[model samples]
Target: MRDFDFHPDEATVRCFAYPASGTVVNDESMWVGQTRQASPYDTMTEDLVLRHFALADEWFKLNATFDLRGILIQPGPPETSFAINCDIATPMVRVGEDVSAVDLFLDVLVRTDGTHRVVDNDEFEQAIGDGLLSTVEARRAEEGLVRLLGWVESGRLASLVHDYALDTVGQAPHPLPVEHWDVENVPSVAPGTRPTWHHG
Candidate 1:
């Protein structure tokens, strides 16, 4: 804890802004270890839900996530199925002492059907052009992206995901817990907005 520069007196929810495809995808949630899982919220039509895990070792930290929307985690051809994905290390910044935000750059989306695609290249390029990220940082992200892609092609990424979740799923700590609620009842604000939720 001493080495960690940012420390909060209590758990604070932060809004993470993600510009994906053509629009900005915002998730407001609390930090759980190195990850943040957004609270279930309603958008214009459907619901948006996600869980992200940033795992670290001595060399580098890799990010993996289960991103889903709508009601159930339907199987098979995936009509709103579970997407288990890994990507380059998400670059983040501390908004305050308690809250942090990260950029999901060049993520490799690996689905349950053993199919894959690389996404968010335009967003990553935009980040670099806008001076949101430096050349070195961009290079690091690119390198990480390549490494993750190689893992995916070699079947190592799936193995890593299985091993990681199997070992840590039940053991990892949850710093903030969302109260049980239906989709309509879940807290929601405007798009790209981070709601202020304090846990004492």
Candidate 2:
């Protein structure tokens, strides 16, 4: 095994994500996001790092876990909302195909500035997915499944799905994009910028 550098100079950065409008960003949507804690031999933060790669490499929508402070960029919603959804069966929470388990670790938040506009919940997930995919290297044709498995174990991602009530294997053979994470939105990055989706 090898060690990985999971350090970000800043706890946060400005970025953009795909909207749930079923279209790739005509233009990048501006956003400010936080970085995860540092860990030695750490892979837990790969989900976040993979997103950074995705953003710099090309347009992509990825599934991820998040701590939404608020509609940092978007505006107010029709009403205030706060909820949590665990046991994520969606691809956003997948450890990998054929190796994901049942467990719940998701959050749902809705808050508005009470003016201008409101952030759509669907859009929020859409943006997060895009943000993660941006950080992660786009899926590989041959190694996509392999990388997914490696990421699952290397990053301690199994904890998220170790205790699912489903009582099934921690794997899903056919993973589908949530309503917003359609394959059309997953773009291939240009040459040179393509990140190597390595697992340590």
Candidate 3:
């Protein structure tokens, strides 16, 4: 197969999910977020150049991965928060479709200055202990997180985000009002089976 250049100006709806309330080791609440992007990939997938990040999130959430429907974002450093606009849903989807809405939460790395870094160690560890994640899967997630930290420390991530936002000027997706993400909503999706597309 030919390699994809991961050209910018593509639009896609992306999701970031966390462990739901009442699950084993339910130390945290649920956070479901989505973004319309000028590129098809998120920071983890874009930075690590691995589809693994996207795949891992889906496996952990036990839900169907949203279809990409667009070009994949290229492997590169992550974009800064300022570079992309995001909408986070409240009362995340945790149980049955007809379940009631609950408080929403996101697993993040918050610096002393109040800036935040998105991270998922808690979910990975909990899943592993619950026998939902294998040793190999946990290791891969750790590796990806470490690699992301390296880019942040070196300041490469900021530069990449700046460049991508600049390049995709006209093609950026229309932003949803920030408040739309705050609704107490439940998702209609059923728990997923092992994905045939998941290699890890």
Question: Candidate 1, after superposition: displacement of residue 41 in Å?
Answer: 12
- For residue 108, what is the lDDT in candidate 1? 64
What would the per-residue lDDT of candidate 3 be over residues 1-200, giving only the tens digit for each residue?
00001101112112222222211112123222223334354544421111111111222211111213322232224343322211111122234321112111123332222344654445545555765433444454455455545544665433333322232222223333322221212122211222211233
Give candidate 2's root-mean-square deviation (CA, Å). 18.8
Quantify how close model 1 is to the true structure by its C-alpha RMSD in Å: 13.2
**lDDT values of the candidates?**
0.39, 0.22, 0.28
Question: Which ranges of candidate 3 are over 4 A from the true structure?
Answer: 1-120, 165-167, 175-200
Of candidate 1, the 10-residue stretch with the lowest lDDT total is 1-10
Compared with the true structure, what per-residue lDDT tens digits does model 2 show for residues 152-180?
A: 44643333222222211111122122222
lDDT ranking, best first: 1, 3, 2
Rank candidates, TM-score, best first: 1, 3, 2
- Cα lDDT of candidate 1 equals 0.39
TM-score of 1: 0.47
- Per-residue lDDT, model 1, residue 138, is 63
Query: What value does the lDDT take at residue 144 in candidate 2?
Result: 36
RMSD of each: 13.2, 18.8, 16.0
Cand. 2 Cα-lDDT:
0.22
lDDT at 200, model 2: 7
* Tens-digit lDDT track of model 1 for 1-200: 00011111112223333322111112232222322234343332222233343333211133444323222121224444335545454333224332232333565666655577777788778766865554555676777677767776888766654442332332222234332222222222111221211110
